[model samples]
Target chain A: MRAATASVAAEVEDLRRRYGAREALAGVSFRVARGEIFGLLGPNGSGKTTLFKILATLLPATGGRVRLLGLDPAREARAIRRRLGVVFQHPGLDPKLTVLENLRHHGHLFGMRGRALAGRALALLGGLGLDDRAHERVETLSGGLARRVELAKALLPRPELLVLDEPSTGLDPGARRGFVAHLDRLRREDGVTVLLTTHLLEEAERCDRVGILDQGRLVALDTPGALKERVGGDVVVVHARDPEALRAGMRNKLGREPALVDGLLRLEHPRAPELVREVMEAFEDEVIAVSFGKPTIEDVFIRLTGRRLREGGPA
Target chain B: MMGLVLPVTTLWWREVVRFGRQRSRVVGAVAQPLVFWLLLGGGLSASFRPPGAPPGTGYLEYFYPGIIALVLLFTAIFATIATVEDRRTGFLQGVLVAPVGPWGIVLGQALGGTTLAVLQGGLFLLLAPALGLAVSPASVAAVLGVMVLVAFGLTGLGLAIAWRMDSTQGFHAIMNLILFPMWLLSGAFFPASGLPAWLEWAMRVNPMTYGVAALRHTLYLEVPVAAGAVPPLGPSLAVMGAFAVLAYLAAVRAAGRKAS
Candidate 1:
């Protein structure tokens, strides 16, 4: 079991890509183990898309090295593509073709044919719960259903590695969950390795490992539980009038400064409940509400980069 | 090799299937050229007599082969517009990552466009007898052969242009600014013999002019015309064949380069 899990499915060492004066990926590095579901999490303009394009072989890296299935992407891209399946952030299905037609065409591109191709496509549709609508045009299907067809098409060649760019972009919560579950099933049943990029924290949480990117740099890389523990304690958010005054008063009294964010005093402590109670009682006039909970992936991001996971509004 | 042939056939099949689904494209491809033939041919028949002609040929008969060439040009340009659409909708992204090279993708599109152009041009040939032109088996076969050559070259040119354009509007503007004028000056609307020296020289040098001249030569193979009237068949075919190969190479080169 140890030997089986130690094999690397994909690797990137100090990979970099630049567009004119702007650096999209700056010396990023990571390795995905066989059958692992690795996720790259970052908000818009964070270079995750640029990195995804390079891995897909649609774009070339300006510096460093990348290996897919132990094959160099710059030199052996065709060989790597033979063993890799890709799903883009936008829909790749031909809207005019039926779901089965789309899958069959993809199989043909991989040199698949006749009974074997048809059976593989139908079986994948059945697995994805889309067999009943196989004959329907892709344009007639819902976004979630079309996404399932795209997944079925990619799996037709039985690829060793599957790369998806922002796989859950437009999917609803339920659909996203269903999509992730399908990836899990592929990993368990076929031993296919998955590398997906997304800005959704919940989506990253479901992966075996997550790489958090911020402005072309990876800020953190670890299992969700391990990364969350970096905060070391519960997160406490204190809502009050004149948050700066309350923050100053708390610093003078408690000898620890709480971060002022969006008109709230936030802090991390081992004894969050006791601290919340003390703050409520001492500054009862200034305090509006005090809430505390175990640190989440969002808190982990906030701790590493003094900014929220999303800006302007919630993800 | 399976690596090259399979993707080309599949991509080609996709273009044909998509063209079938969009009924408007079918009607527009056939109808637009038919309208041009009728309006222009009818208005000019009385005053126009192609230079060095057999004396009694009307403009309707004179412009018949030119209209067929126009049909091919239209079909090829419209068919290759899918490249821009495929890029815009992210469909081409999927194909680009496949094991196939850019040659496979461009060839598939060029062949798909050729098939559509030949199919439509053949249908237009049915109207030849109406203009007192003979419809013989030899002429029909030869005309289709010429149609395939001309269509393939035109489609490759279209793909070469379409692959570099980010928007369909830009493609339209380029086609208008470049291709439409080339078609008008390709000896399609007027005989090259009677034009001003410079304009006639332009017609002689235009690759599309050779394609139109070849179609005219093939359409009248059964009933021969004057020597040096339409361009010689051997040189016309050679020019068209070279254009097809060059244009296809250009398209593959465009697709091979990274967009960044």
Candidate 2:
């Protein structure tokens, strides 16, 4: 299929960032259509935050171009800032102020004030279901409530583009679900374009499209279904005490080589359960356990990058 | 017109609220200069006697203007620490990404810090009578003018320092390294006389010296002696005013660069 049109809300081409001797972003590129909820999925230190910062005009890109609402982020930064709202990966709410005061301060930064500012803040808090706690200090709120306040602050100005970096990092399951639902409501009801970065697979699935980022490079970009279909077959997992030996035996006996990571052997085949039974028969008591399931986003990630999405070590 | 005023006023109000919230900071801002004024002035007065010191020159009287200058200097210098904190806490990021110009952040912070400095200077003025200094209405206004100038210069310097600093520890070190020499050499605690020739030359180039001199002149009605000859107060005010303008421009540039 042909790619979508390039009339995008945010466009970044070959964006690169260097921190002293280290290169944080190396030739990264992506585009988000207007009013689309786009997700950037990557582990820590994968240049997701750097990309977000560059787009927000908080950090200048060392090389390449970034455009938000068709204006260069570098030269037209003030114009871009006027139209963009950014919620950084870290908690940005002022702890000293109440939730309403925090929103008021955020509005003031954008040249808003008085009764209008108060009314807008109240409306935003009301929309976020946080009006009841508006008078409470941010420090007194729970992590989930604070996150909602941050979101409300970002939405106070009714920005054209919203950039959220790991917005649901420390939230509980219910909070994360509610936050995602709120984002969906914004996209559907208000038509606000959202560009979010997250490491959670389920959160990424909620986006209309996902960009899989690894080592500062976008490895894959597609809808969740497309990404999953790219894996081709059911994921057969063969757990063994010695994966190397089992993988070699499977390669030699069944003429099928599976990807072995740690103690789990993963393979994509037409009849995964049948293959699992055959493998069990071939290995007999040698195989510790065997499991088969549909391919997950994690599987796609490992297939493309040769590393688990949540696994740690080197990128 | 109201739109323009609203944003700046709201930002300024937020800073004021933040200052009020930090109880420890309020105490420190006021207490540091007052203690320094009393202890250092009293100790130095007991130990040394000038050959031709002015009459009715108690330690408090001689050190009062310096203490005021110190109040302005310390308040401005320590305000940079708040900037570093704001950066780490994501408040600075929010400000930078706002629709406002970079100068708004710089000007707002300077204005906030200056207001606090002026308030603290007022407290020092109220404590002046107990410290043997006269506080007439005109004298109070004059002292406020001098404090405003000193606050402007120091806040500009603070903004400049904060622009390049990424950590609180680095900011603290730079503040100590730069401000101590400025205060000591500017004759804030001691008269600049009897120093080595080269040291005197250094003091001549220090902007704080002119601020301290102008403040002393306004507060005590004393003429500032430059190179052993008392220069006119107009020249001293002009010198400090020039530094204030230059520092403000530099601060604005630094803030713009930081936002980038």
Candidate 3:
């Protein structure tokens, strides 16, 4: 038998990508341990796709070293791909093909055939609660069902590592929860290492660890809880329609400068309920809107980089 | 060995399934070539004739094999749009991320396109008898062999072009500029003779010219062993075989490029 290798699912060192003159990924380094669900959290243009492509062996990095499942992606690409299951951000399923047909083709490409392949496919469909829709065309299925099929196809070969790019892009809230629960069960039972890229805070929150990438560089890397903890305790965003007087008055009186992003003041404090009251009393006429809660990955983004996460469509 | 074979078979089967699902592709692939052959052949038969033609061979009869070659080229080229569609629809990304080698990917797609071209071209050849030509079984067999070679070459050329293109519009530009002119210069529309010196040289050197010549030579097997106007059997097959090899290599090289 081949001896077991290192437990690292993925290892990247000083990864960089350049398109013409713009650097897409600049010196990003991180490691995902075996059997861990790691999320590469970033907004649009944060180089998540570039890094994902490199790790998946679909695109080469301009400068850096990457290893997937303990094998160099450049030299041992075939070996890495053999053990890697990838779910792309775009729809990879052939819409004209039936769910079972797509899975069959995917299995055959991975050298899975005969009765064994059929049995495994059937099991995956049953496990994913799609046994009845096996013969249905992928185009006819709902977004959630199609996503389930994509997941089924990825797990068909029992891959050691599963890489998903924005797995919850088109999913509804209920479907997204089910998808997360399915991944959780997979981790609990099969111990499959997963690496996913997403811009959603809730999705990143479920990850065992996350690496926050901002503007082609890794800004922070840690557990979502620990990263949130870096923002003190509670998070508050106070929107104000004011001239320069509001900020200057608050700076002189409170002595705590709040981050003004997009004409809004964002600050973190342990006693956010009391702070919200005090800020309201101090600037009642100047305030436009206000909201407060515990810091999420979005707040961590702001706390670390004085910029909002820019809640927008999928990256 | 099974690893390579399995992926190739799966990809090839996918082409067949996709082609079958799209009924319009079948109708369009068969209909467009027939219309072109009839319109061009009928209009030119009144006046156009080669310098030294085979007796009883009018423009329609002369342009018969060229029609088959056109069917192969057009259908083969159009079928390769699946690559661009695969990229747009995100199917090719999955295949690219698979463990399969570049050779397997190229061979699977090439053979899939070749099979569709030959089958589509074979359907067009049934009209040979209706066009007043007696196509014997031997001649049909010979034409089938030539179709396989040209189909493989044309499909490889199409794959090389389509793999690099990110959009169907860019692919359309290439088809018009490169593919159509290639067919036009392949002695398909007119014979290589009775042309200017430079034009004649272009026809002689064109690889598809040999493809057209090969098909024409095979279709005349029922005729006298010695044929006129058409190039010799030896050089045409040699050129086609070389073209198939070189085009396939070029396609594999394109597919294997790291940063595209």
Taking all chains together, each candidate's TM-score versus the true structure is 0.96, 0.94, 0.96
Order of candidates by DockQ, top first?
Answer: 3, 2, 1
Worst 10 residues of 1 chain A by lDDT: A1-10
* Residues A1-315, model 2: lDDT tens digits: 124333588888998999998898989888899889999998778888888788778889999888788888778988888889898877888898899888888888887778999999998888888879989889899988889988888898989899998989899999999999999998888889999999888899889999998998999999988999998688888778788988888889889889976458889987687887888889976788788888877778889988778775322
Predicted complex 2: CAPRI docking category: medium
How much RMSD separates candidate 1 from the native structure? 2.2
**lDDT tens readout by residue for model 2, B24-137:** 989898888878876888788876653235555666676777788888887887687887778788887887888776567777787888888898888887876786655567
In the range A81-137, model 1's lDDT, one tens digit per residue, is 889999998999999999999998888888898999999999999999998999999
lDDT of 1 by residue, B1-260 (tens): 65678788888899999999999999999999999999999999989878777888888888888898999999988976878899889888888877887888899889999999999999999998888787689989999999999999999999998888888987767788888877988888888876789998888889999998888888888666721277888999999999999999998988887432
Q: What is the C-alpha lDDT profile of model 3 across A233-278, one tens digit per residue? A: 8888887887366778778877767887766777788989988898
Better of 2 and 3 by lDDT: 3
Candidate 3 colliding pairs? none
Tell me how far the alpha carbon of residue B94 in candidate 1 is from the true structure, in angstroms, after superposition: 1.1
| Model 1 stretches with alpha carbons more than 4 Å out | A1-6, A239-245, A261-264, A282-291, B226-228, B258-260
DockQ pick, better of 2 and 3: 3
Candidate 3 accuracy as lDDT: 0.86
Q: What clash pairs does model 1 have?
A: none
Using DockQ as the measure, which candidate wins? 3
